[model samples]
Target: MREIKVQLYRGEDDNYVELWKTVEKIEGKHRYYGRYTYGNEGTWYSVCDPLGYCELNAPMADDVMFICCDENGNEAIRYSNADGNKLPKFETVIKREWNKAKEKLQHNTEDLTKNFWAECWNGDTTMKINQWLLSYKDPDLYPEKANDYDENWTGCWAEKEIGYEPIPDTEFEYLGHKYQFTKVKHKHEYCGIEWYEFVCTDSPYVMRDTPWVNDRAWIQSYMYLGNWFDDKTYGTMYDQRSAREKVVAALIKKFPMKNKWDKLLYVKKKTGNEFYNCDCCYEKSYSDMADVLINRNYHRKDVDYLCKFINKETEGIVFASNRGNKYTIRQTYPDIYDYDNCLI
Candidate 1:
């Protein structure tokens, strides 16, 4: 027999009251069923029914006091809100009771590993290695073994099958900053060939400030093992270059220089002359060609000369000579000609 503390409250009262009850083990299960109520004055009292007995399947009232406990009344499982307090949270108490009923009889790692692999594949190598290592030791006695086993089990497994060899640490500069090589992983892709994956320790400032680049961007800049050898001559040349040189070349190729004039040309071709004109003139134009050209950063002497040159080179290019309005060119013919058609 063991005593367990439970909290219960009356329907009309907001305060919870604590109760202690003794439970007896019968046929490997705790059994206790009794109904006790306080009098109208709400005074506490005790009732003992020595001959009364009930099965575990009996319906319990909403305010019944119960806690999850083993046969000896020791707390078998920790509840999220138990906190060793008299009044445990309502939801935590319910969860504790539910878990006590649905507890697993044994731990099965095979099923758990299969489920984990099915969901995420072997991408989570850390979890797979930890689970595999735990199977070799008694978790209860050697609880700290999992924390101490920090070997790269995945790399060891790959090395056995692929004959993969790790490269020593190397330092290189990228984008005006230095980075240090950390580790490598090689996987067998063909009968006699293996592909390598490199990991580098990137600077914190570079990782945070760079807009589109991440830590893995350095490795991805280089071609994959299979593709690296596709160009026979270039591959031979690449093999000859030092590691630092190869990394520098990959980084340079990844972010190629852009020609400012070429970018301007591309914008002009895509958006047409209106965009170029507006861009160069700051979107400000007059009604006359002379005034428009003058406002567009052309000198006073060169404005007339350029206007005349443009009028000869383009069709329907004529200057409006109206004094009431600003002088500008009419590139298209209107139904009525309201301005003097000056050749320039």
Candidate 2:
């Protein structure tokens, strides 16, 4: 443990030292364990990092406590001039400053939560939340570091302060549909697994709204392979899946394998794999058996059902699984696109 010192100042009218911190260890970390600042005379000092969520001009106001260190950071006298200052107990001042910072952080979090819900719902989502913190004038919130704020910070704040990512109302034209996705900033978006809005190019205005879907196939077919919205902004990453793969996933999700023809069902009925062979294919588990069946062309009937769904919904979207469920997009690369084994 390195020797360090703490100081309390009025930090209101002027930067006058009010008290010296005689004790150490408030909550297990250094008193100034957040950020650093460069001084006018060339020096480095600690600043509360989370205090960035609070205003520096707060009444009674910001950082009355500061961390002071020397060039070699040698042990320093705890209370050099306490008798002259007639200061309160070291904990008293520390708690006072600490409590204020906590209350301010809580207040900011509540404020952020209120503002986000108000704009997200009410049918007027502009999806321009990157500038949500910019409306309030400075000296109130991060006035000193306002220029450094942007979508990156906004996203980070939402996760930390707001506790959820804001899902913007995004739309796109692909796979013969004009789709849109909207949600309360704190909710999760989808990929046939999460949640989103999907509609064809000619969808009626009345049919344009976020829907609660139970099946991945229904939503994944309409979502971006990754997504138009930056997942990083929400403290999340969008999945990378091919459109054809998504279609196949949907088909497989829709497939009925209750019959004996499916290897899983065959194993269930026989209840023994000692010397069993799914046409010279042997597996001890259902997952392994399924992969063997699909990759080895044991799913000929499955292809028919899958390709039918793609053709009817996407119109000429030839689904191919030659490359392990991920097929080529015919419109973009026809020469390499092959559906001969698709059986549809």
Candidate 3:
């Protein structure tokens, strides 16, 4: 008997993995079942059978080619059946599914409005008048270093007054006197759904014009990805005395924001590894526009659906340099571009 395990992004589905009994039809295909790890990270799996043959269909973009391993975790066999067995062709099927899923993932009425607010608010701090704090750390330090304001308040104010310069108290001392070392600055922007025009509903005369509520119904300011908006202003300042230092920094800065905790009170999904800090303004100000770009589905078709929805709604605002949620199908899956087994 030939045993096979089918998986969707490494999922345990019998339909995807076809198995054929030794006495059963060998010319036709069969389905098998198994599982890989969960979450956005990568995963691996193995399968061992008394019988030696198992063939697989073409894998999707995110699907990694399986490698059968021995008990000691060494590579054993290629993830295919006999030498004569062949994989399925996915060019036509993948393209068809891609188009269909893309259309299906289009945001609903609520989603359209909510996603718009999230994108707008994530750009600048329009939630609270003109006050814009890069990240929560900036606002938290505001109260502590408020008394240390020594520069002339008349001018635009030095970087110190605006919470950009390093505070003496928060510094680490090294040589003679007080040495102020490097501090990680988490940069971000904030705004809200009200800034846009389409979200409004009621008549201009009767409805109240408040920043929080508009005709289009705003989506609250919920935190998205971390360091997605970092401006790289945390580097050494030439003017400061102790500006130079050899240090390692995470390409993606990680700063804990306050609003994230408050938002959790309203939305119960803020627990565990899912909680990402908000970048709106400086402090923790919960607005009515929040959402994430990540699609928590295992299927490549499903992921493509969510990406298409984003592409349509954002109107090209979704890029690493441009505004809104930044993402790439390539980053998540390299196999999607392969011609023979592509899943795009």
**Clash count for each candidate, listed in order shown:** 6, 4, 24
Ranking by TM-score: 2, 3, 1
Candidate 3 wrong stretches, greater than 4 Å: 1-5, 9-136, 139-141, 144-344
Residue 282's C-alpha lDDT in candidate 3?
15
Question: What are the lDDT figures for the candidates, one per model?
Answer: 0.29, 0.29, 0.25
| 10 residues in a row with least lDDT, candidate 1 | 260-269
Q: Estimate each model's TM-score.
A: 0.14, 0.16, 0.16
lDDT (tens digit, per residue) of candidate 2 on 1-344: 23445533212212321222323667775343221111211122333332333112211213233234322333322222211222333323333433433332211112344445745542111232322222221222344533442332333222311121222333332212343322212222211112122112112222222344332112222211111233223211111112224333554554434543432111122224634422121222233433322342212244345445643543322222223323323223334312232311
Query: In candidate 2, what residue range of length 10 has the lowest lDDT sum?
Result: 234-243
Rate residue 191 of model 3 by lDDT.
14
Q: Could you give me the TM-score of model 2 versus the true structure?
A: 0.16
Instruction: Give the alpha carbon lDDT tens digit for every residue of 1-344 in model 3.
Output: 33333323222223233322222223684323232222211222233341243333333233334443333334434243223122221222233333343343222122334434633644222221111122222323344533332122111122211012222232221111122211112212211101111111111112223465333222221111111122333211111101100000110111223333432111112234433432111111122211222211112343334434533533322222211211233343333222222112
Segments in model 1 whose C-alpha atoms lie over 4 Å from true places: 1-22, 25-59, 67-127, 130-344
* Per-model root-mean-square deviation over C-alphas: 26.4, 23.5, 29.9
Clashing pairs for predicted structure model 1, backbone only: 287-328, 288-327, 288-328, 289-327, 289-328, 289-329
